[model samples]
Every structure is written in structure tokens, then in C-alpha cells.
Target: MPVMPVDRRTLLKAGGALAAVTIAGCTDSPSGHASPSAPPGPDVAVAPDWAGFGRGLDGRLYRPGGSGYAAAHQLFNPRFDSVQPGGVVKAASIADIRESVLFARKNRLTCVPKAGGHSYVGASSIANGLMVDIGNLRSMSYANGVLTVGAGARLYDVHAFLDRYGRSLPTGTCPTVGVAGLALGGGMGVHTRAYGLTGDRIMSMQVVTADGVFRPCSPTQNADLFWALRGGGGGNLGIVTSFRLSTIPGGKLGLFILKWTQSQAAAVIRGWQRFAREAPTSSWANLHLDARSDGTIAVRAVGVSTTGSATAAAAQLESFIGIRASSRSFSQKSHLEAVRFLGGGTSSPRTGFTAGSDVLRGPMDASTISALVGAVKARAGAGMTASAILDPLGGQAAKVPTGGSAWPWRSSLGVIQWYVGLAAHPTAASYNSARSWITSGHRAVAKASAGGYVNYVEPGRAIQSYYASSFARLKTVKRKYDPANVFHTPYSIS
Candidate 1:
């Protein structure tokens, strides 16, 4: 979803009414409420026994021309609305998930699972295929310092549920992202440096593999699958029904945002990198070079300190920057307060944007930083908004031993996201312009970047770029679990 990279409030601040698409299978709170109906799409042809298949499921099925078909197929990004699924199974239980998989395998139909519908490449939905929508399977419980969450649970609901027990999980800022996708793709967020990626905390999970078998994976049972499940990226090995993860104590955190003019971007970038590298594991800061509505870029440092005052953290950052911020704000906030503050305003259920990423190998030199700053400045315009966001990754995230999980970039500096939010109705030319800017940004940092983050997956990018050295092992696991390649996407292991 690039939810952590491109802030929706920042996108709105760039100035434009976002093209609205009725949201489906997503909610900002734990409570369930009826969703607005979407105009039904054209009737689609279906398998002869599709009705019988629907009747056998515990959850409701939405075939094309059905009441919920349009809403059932919607994803977080409206950019891929053209690729409509022929049918959707809103799985209500693990049994429903297994049945859906079995049905798809027997029918020889493409099957994809839709969690939070945040796939950057829209892998959550398939064209004329059967979609096993797990959004209805959201269920959560916390006991014995472990939180067990249904695969469909969103960040907001998860956090809310945990807050009741004064527990927290390392998660991205965006509240609507599915826990399954984030944890599976090596979740990175404000808490990354202190706690490590969300995948690192996963102790066990329940999955419905391609062969329609329900399996429990943990360090002691189905160990190989357990290793692969963490940071392997969802939809590659199976449909995850639930996850059991370790939790951290919820308490107050120091939050701060320091800003500087674009003139100070290069200096700020250099200084931020040094500070981030030296900052204690309890502190984390992300640099954002955002294109404003006025055709100028804004440089800002946003971070959190779990153990000290926000003012002290800000001062420490300033000491490294060697320059005073034009403006800054620091405060101590409770865990829930911090979550809401960091979530920002404008949590649009749907957004129009194209984003990609690069995982930094190490600190970038002055020249490379200059080129990156110049790239964003050159891309700023009236119609679209561009942002260069870098989230630090070296603290406890790197402590995981080699081969601890499928995530390969733990030893890296951070993930650099190149993002552009589009206009109400973007033309092909506009999309080309946006993509070209992303390409230019990539070229600027290609020397320092080792690979791309799987969560921020992009089309045409090599699959190996995401897994790196782990790709071979992942392919082996995939072959063993799904030899027929029934669970497949453009970037899925073959």
C-alpha cells in the first residue's frame, strides 16, 4: 500500500479532490458496519457448478452480477479496477478458505486471496479469476504475551484491540493495512528500530496451503514452512488464516517532527542518516522530502523515542544535523495517542497513486544525496505530488541471524520509497510522467540501493530484487508446496 511511505494527509495537502471509490472489505475501527453498495459490474460467465460451490461455503459468495460482486472485488488502489474477478468468496472460517482453495484447484481457476487489498501491484485481485476474500475473517485475541490475529485484521483494529490490554505490536503507520501482508513482507514502521520487523515477532501461524490442507506452523512444528512464512510475502506459499505474534508493553512514547526548507534538504539528508545510524534502538526517524502544492519541496524528519522526552530526541537530531530546524514540535504521547498522531488525517479507504522502493545498502554519499534531492525537485509540478521517504532499518531488525527468515535486507540501512499521488483522473501521459520520475529517482540511488522491499512491490521489477539470496530457498519451498503453480502472481515464486 506504500501506506507508510506516502502519507495520505500529505497527498491531500498537495491539493486535489481524490477520485473516490466506494471502499469494500476495509474499516477504520473494530466494530462492524454495513458498507455502501457499489454499482454492480457487468454479468460475467461462471463455471457450470458455481452455484453449488457457493452453497457449500460457510461464507457468502459473490459471483459477477450478484449484489456484492462490485464491492467484493474492490482493492485499496483503484488503479487496478479494470481487473475484475469473476467471483469472490468472502470466507467466514478456515473451512471456507479451504473449500475455496479446493474449488479453485478442481476448476483449474486462478485463485488469489484478498486481505487488506493493499498490494501495490494489485496481486490481491485477478482478472476473471476466483478471489478468496478473507476480509471477513477478522478475529483477534491476546493471551500470555502473544496476540493471535485473523489474517484479515487491519492495523487499526489490531491496535485498538491490543490497546485494551495495554499491549502493542510493531506495525506500519497506515491503519487500514492488513496484518497478514505487512508481517509476511517484513513489516517496517516507526517501531522497527526498537522491536524489529513485524515478521520477527511472529511465533506461529495457521495457513491453508494451495493443496487445501490446513497447517499449523511454528518453530517446533512445520518448522520449514514457519521460516518461509515470515517475510516470504503472502500469496506465495498459501492463504494465511491466522498469526500468533509476540507483543510489547504499551506505554508513552516521545514523538517529534522537525522541518527545514528545501534549501537544507541535502544537508538534512546527510545529517539524518548519521543521526539515525547512531541513535539508540529506542528511537526511530524517517526523512521525507515532499512536493508541496506550491511546486516546492519540503524537508522534514519525523520520529519516535520510546524511552525519553521528545524534546531531547529532537535536540539530539539537531546536534547531528548541525543546523536548526525551521520549525519543530515534540510531545510525549500514550501508545494509542501516538498511533493516532502518526496515522495522520485523511485515511481514505481508496487512493490513486503509484509507488516503488529501494532498500539502501548503506549510508549514501553527498553526491548521491544531491542527485536524489534534485530528482524530486525536478519532478515537482502542479498536477501530481511526489515524495521521497526513507525509513531506518538497522537496529534490532539487523540482529536477526542470517537465514532467520526470508527477509534479506535486515543488515541494510533502510527502505527508500519513491512515490507520486495522481490527480482525480490521470491521463496515460500523467501516469508516464509519474513513472518516469520514479525511474529517475531509482537511477539516482541505484548505486547505494541493493534491492526493493517486497511489500512495496512494483511491476516489471525482478522477483530476486525482493528476496535476494533467499530467492532460491523460497523457490524450493514454493515448488514443494505448490508444484502445480496454482498459487501464482506476476512475482510469485514459480
Candidate 2:
């Protein structure tokens, strides 16, 4: 039931800190052959001039047979390798993005924006559609206390850049995750409690709407669109070129990692819930219940303290659990060091997994915890690797007013992510097992769950679950900005 003396390697993998991005690229056609054309739609008959389209752009375009096309279409998740786009434009500037959007609209082609290509459901990629790769738009600058970064910048690069000026922004720990996707879907991480969410720091944004019109969004400009962009899921309204956000001073941060046996899972969970809800805003922790391949559970707590000694933070956690950790480590680190440490030590890209989430309204009951534990154990017993990671949403995160942004989970206790590692070539049976386990997880927490997080979206669930009460307003925004539904995905507000 419990695993003792859990090592760091096992913990990182289980918690997805080491989840890498896979870049296998497209294999739809043989090498040297032309890319397959999408079946014609009812309204379109003539093919657009590919060479002519490429000539007018400042950025380069990649077709099926063009160099770099494969890499341009690659996504973080390997499962989407087969979904190849008809064309990929590496937009170099705002003008390039506007031109791409206008081109897609003129040709009535489906166009998807690719910031970091980390869409959990592969929404960033499209089958036989045009994919706009904004990876070349990365540009960063710091002025006064505001950090203006291109939407295409990855977390690690952003962190490293900010560290140079002794500044930091609230963002996810995954180094390869894109700033646009993470911030748009309501970023939650080590700095969340201490600094609120990444989006909360946003001062303004440069976005290219569905009409190919470039608009500046902020509290004072395009106010409605700005509110929607804060927590509104990406690929819904438009493509964000860059963002201007307020930054906090960077300095030494106290970090702690504590491990507990699964035998104390119940007490540790209950305690963590209370501690997360009551802890000082300067202190934050995430509880990870990771299932190893050997069919044992690894229980751990990893967090940071923006205020005092991490040793004190560790002791406070013990008091709540009513027991001491089996082992613990405490260290003080510079902002960049902490970012790398919490990011699982490396940013090497590789990927093969399926994940989803449930937002907890409060501490789960004993029965629900038992059910969750049982589901994990059962799935592991069947030879599937799984993990449940819970990140708290209290503190300043909840202080945002209801209408402040589209993110409706301000009052949530935390978000529980159900993650399952997939094989290089997963079988149907493996998918079935994973689906079953996730279903059980949803059923177990159904009573205490407010809904699901948009960032950890899954298939087959109602879109309303992500936005809750704000869904209606989001739809209204959608209608106003994208009445033609140009930027649409399976879970878009429309």
C-alpha cells in the first residue's frame, strides 16, 4: 500500500515535472512526396497559390515537401504526430500574423495558432488545416516594473530572461510550456499563492482577432476582450502576439520537499487541504500522490516559501499532518535556480501521456479519498502508471472578484490532475484502462468538485464545466469577437 524512502527520480516522473515533449513530426506521407491535400469543402473549389502566398509573407512558410515542415508541425504530445497541417507559417512579426489570418479567411481554411504546441488535446494542430507557428515571434523586454514578452516564449526562456533583471512572473513549472497557453488557461504554480496567477499580472496584450484586425487589450482598452483573455481558454478569441505583465522582484526563495508513506495518505491529504486553505499567502505547497510501476504509491509534498525559513514551513506542514515526513530536504535558492529545480531539473522535450483535471471546491471526504486511492492502486496493479497532483487555489488567487476574469475557479480549494503515462505505441487496452481510471476519479470527487480546469481539458466533457457560471458571458464575448467562429476548437466558448 505504501512505498518507503521514495527517491527524487520516481517523484519527478510521477508528478510530471519530467514530462518531456516528443518531436516525431508528421509521417503521413513518405519522404520526398508532396503533402496530401485536404478533401475539398462544399464552398471552396480552386486551390490557393501556395508559392504566391509564401512570397507576400515576411515569415517563411512550410509545405508538406518543404524543409522544416515536419518540425514546424510537431507538438508536445506524441499522440498528435499523425495530425499534420497542410501548411505551417513561422510568423516573424505582427504583420505576418495578420497576413496569415487574412489568408486563411480568404481561402476559408481552418487555421490554428501554435505558441509552444502543448495543447493537451492537440487543439493546437489541425488535420489538413493551416497551422500558424508563432515560435519566431519571441521578443522580451523589461521596463519599469512591467515585463513585455512575446506569446511564443517558453517558460524556461522567459524565466531565464527575467532572472537577468531580478524579476519573476507567476507561471507553470514546465519549462517547455508556452507563456500564451499557460497564462490564457489560468496558470497555477509555486508562485500562485504568493503572487496570484500569471494572468493577474497582465497589464495589456497585443492580439490579432478573427477579423485580422490588430487590437490592444487591457483594463482600459478593449476591456471586455481583456477580461476574457485572462482566463479564457486559448484558441477561442484570437492569437495573442505579446503580453505586458507586472513583475515581482526576484530573490532567494525557501524551498522544501517532503515525502510521506502512502499509509498516511488519508491524514496527509486531510491535513494538506486545511494547511493550503489556512497557510500564509507567502507559503505554498502541492500534494502529489504518484503511482509507481511496481504498484506502490509515492506520497510527497513540494513547495516554496516567499517569506521566512523553509525549515519552518516544513515543520508547520508536519503539525497539520499530525506526523513527521519520512524524509525531507530544505534549501534556499535564487529565483532561476528554484525555477529549474521545480521544473524537474531539465527542459528536454519528449511526450507520451493523457491527463485531465477536477477542481475541488473543498477538502474531500474520507470516502472520496479512499475511492481515489483505490482507483490509483487498481490502475497501477493493471500495469498502468498514474498520478494525482493537487495544487492549491486559495490565498490571493481567490481574492479576484467573480467578474474580474473568465476563470471561474477562484474559490476552488485546488485542482487535482489525473495523469497517465502512455507507451510509445499504446494499445487500445491501455487507453481503455486509462479512461476507466479517469472515470473513477471523476466519480470519486464528483461530490466535492466544482468543475474542471480548462488547461487540463479532456474529451467528452461538457464545455460548461471549465467556465461554470461564466460560460454564458464567454459565449457573448465569442459572438462579439468571432461571430464567424474562425478560432474554434472542440471546447471553445461557442
Candidate 3:
């Protein structure tokens, strides 16, 4: 039977109404309830046996036509607009994942592995394929300071779980980002300065390979596969079921936010470059410059340190900008709190936003910074807020051996992220500005950096440029793992 088409306006109206109702009275408190609804997209034909596949060995299947399917498809990134999978197999156990992969391989259909659904590029969750939704695989076990988390688990959940034992890992700030994609793609977060990317902390992984075989991977066994899994990007190699991560003792961390005006943009950026290079590994900073409504520029300096003392870190960072703060938000927060602040708490829904990223080895000159700021200032709109974020690299990030993993940008000083939000219809002018800013900003920063971050790439750019030096090796791995290129997406090696 052909699937019935729903009007785009109707879908939006329905989704908005449902969201408002579900989130109406919910507070931003950590204990607030999460609304369960299907992601906004056209309805697709689900297989007749979708219900059977949804059932676990325990006999409970979550079906797309059922209530659970609606809730299960709601992931963190909202840009993905394709239909829901023909069917969703909500894997409640590792065995379920194995069974689903085997079934999909035998049937000769495509399969997309979904963790937290936080894939900004929409690769984590797919449309019209066998969607192996892994949200229910939320088991966590800790022993001897090593934490083992299920792939379906979210970063915030891991933080809360480990916090009980006074331990933590270097995961990204977005609480909802899946551990599978982030860890597999070289996660960068608040603790990266002190501990390194989340990939560095991974001790082992329980993976379902492309051939439908289940095995444990680590540095000693399946060593080549282990290298590929770390920073090689997810889904291509296999479905990662669980991860064994190294954890550290939790302690107080300092968090500070300093703001500046457009007039001080050049000075602030130059100062940031010097500080990022010289600051101790214990200290980390992020530079955010957005356009204001009144036609002025706004620059915010955010930083965190392993040392409990904010005084020194703040002073060292503040001196570089050499500008008085228009506004400041600072606190001494636990690792969890720091993660929440950096991730932009639950109040801000991840909706209608387009973001792209690049890595920088050095700093942009004053003229480039000025032009970039002007582009952003002239393009502000209701749903549109264009800005750039610079995340410091080096320290432990560079210590990993060259060719140690597929992650190529170990020597990078920081990552440059360009993003814009859209509330209403995106006009040609708005899109043009975004493209121009991203291109110009990337080129301006590229003089200092060689390439871009794979996870944050926009559509239409060459994959070769994104991978740069590591493309050859990654392509070889792609051939070994996915020889037929069955698992292709925006940034797949193939």
C-alpha cells in the first residue's frame, strides 16, 4: 500500500501543538519529564513484521504504528526531515541489536544505528531504512574506576550515573548527544583540556560488526578495529553496543563567561589565540561572537579549569581580551553542573538550527575577524543567530600518536564552529549570508588550520578536504569494513 502524504503545514501544526502540550508545565529542573513524541516527518510504510522485530527476546516490541514508536524517534537534532524508518526496532538488549543487524543484512535493506539522535548531520538516525533505535540500551556498570556504558545512553545520564560514585569522563557538553557517535568521533568537551577527548578514555567496546558478528574490541585484541572505532565515525564499522571508559575522580571546576562588544572583536580574538596556546592544560576556553539586535557585536568568553581556583584562570583569560565585560556569569560547579552550563541547559530546545565546524591551528588576522563580524551583524533574524565558537585543542589531544586513530586533527589549537538558527522561512538572502560567512570564515581561519571537523561539515563540500591528511588511511578502513559502501551518509569515508 502506498503511504499517504501529509501536508507540510499540517505536520508542523500538529508537531507544535503536541510539543506545547507535552512541555507546557514542565520545568527546567533536572527532574523534569521529557515529552515522548514521534519526530516531525512524513509517515512512511513500516514492514508488516515491524511489531515482531520490536519485541525483545522478552516478547515486547515497540512498533512505529504504536505509542512507543512515536516517542522513540524524537532525537536531539531536528534538522533531519526524512520519514521515520519503514520500521523501528527498539533494541532492549545487545542480543536484540545483533538479531536486528543479521535480519537487515539478510534482507538486503539499509540500516541506520541511532543512539541519542544528536547527530547534527542527521547520520545517526535515518529515514526509510531499518532503524535500529538503541535508546533502551541504558545499562551502566562501574568497577575499579572503569565505566562501561551502553551505546544508547546519553552524556547527561552517564554524568549522573558516575556522579554517584564521584567519577566522570570527558564527554561533550550536550547532555542529549549519544555516547556512540561522540566517543567514536573524538568527542570534545569541558574536560578535554585535562583528560583528553572521550575517545581517549575508551578502554573497550562491545560491537556488532558489519557481518553481524558480535565481539569485544580494545587496544590488545581486534587492535585495528579498535583504532578504526576511535574517531573513525560511527555506523560504518558496526553498531557499537557498549563502551568501557576510563573514569577520573570528580572535583570542583571553575566556570566563567565574559562578554565583549563588536568594537573589541579583533583585540579579543587575537588575545584568545595567545591564551589558548599558553594556558595550562588544566584551563580551557571557548570564544563565542554573535550579532546583537541593535547592530552591535557580542563576544562571550567561556572557560573551565580543573583547578578549583577561578581567580587565576579568570584573570589570565580576562587579561588577553583586555575589555571590560558587558555581562558575566561565573560559578564553581561540579563536573555535571559545568557540563550542563556548557551544553546550554534543557530550556533551550535543539530546533531549527544549522551548524558547521572547522579546525584551526592558529589565529585569524584582524581584517578577517572584522569582515566576519560584519557579515554576522548584517544577517540577524528571528530564528537566525549567526555566531562562531572556538574550542581550544592541543595538550592531551595532541599526545596521541600520529596514525594512532582515524582522528587527524590532534595538532589543532582549537575548532571553529559557525552556526545560525531559523525560526521562520529561510530566505535566499539569509541562506546566502550564512554560506558566505561560513566559507569566508573557514578560509580566514584555514590559513592557520589545515582542515575541518568531519562531524560538523555541511552538505556539498568535498569529503577529501574534510579528511585532509587522514583521508587515504580512512578510505582503506572504509573499504575493509564497508566494502560495498552500504552505510553511506554525508561524511562517510567512501
On lDDT, the candidate that comes out on top is 1
Residue 100's C-alpha lDDT in candidate 1?
86
- Model 1 residue 31 CA deviation (Å) reads 36
What lDDT does the true structure give each of the candidates? 0.75, 0.74, 0.63
Q: Per-residue alpha-carbon lDDT of model 1 for 392-482, expressed as tens digits?
A: 8888888873336988887798878877776534567877777788888899998899998887776557889988988999889889888
Number of the top TM-score candidate: 2
**Ten contiguous residues with the weakest lDDT in model 3:** 1-10
Worst 10 residues of 2 by lDDT: 1-10
Compare candidates 2 and 3 on lDDT and give the better one: 2
Clashing pairs for model 3 are: 38-70, 54-61, 55-60, 55-61, 383-421, 383-423, 393-413
Native-vs-model 2 lDDT? 0.74
Task: For candidate 3, write residues 125-154 as lDDT tens digits.
Answer: 455556777878879999999998888887
Q: How displaced is residue 400 in candidate 3, in Å?
A: 0.2
Better of 1 and 2 by TM-score: 2
RMSD of 2: 5.7
List the candidates' TM-scores in order: 0.90, 0.91, 0.83
- As a TM-score, model 3 comes out at 0.83
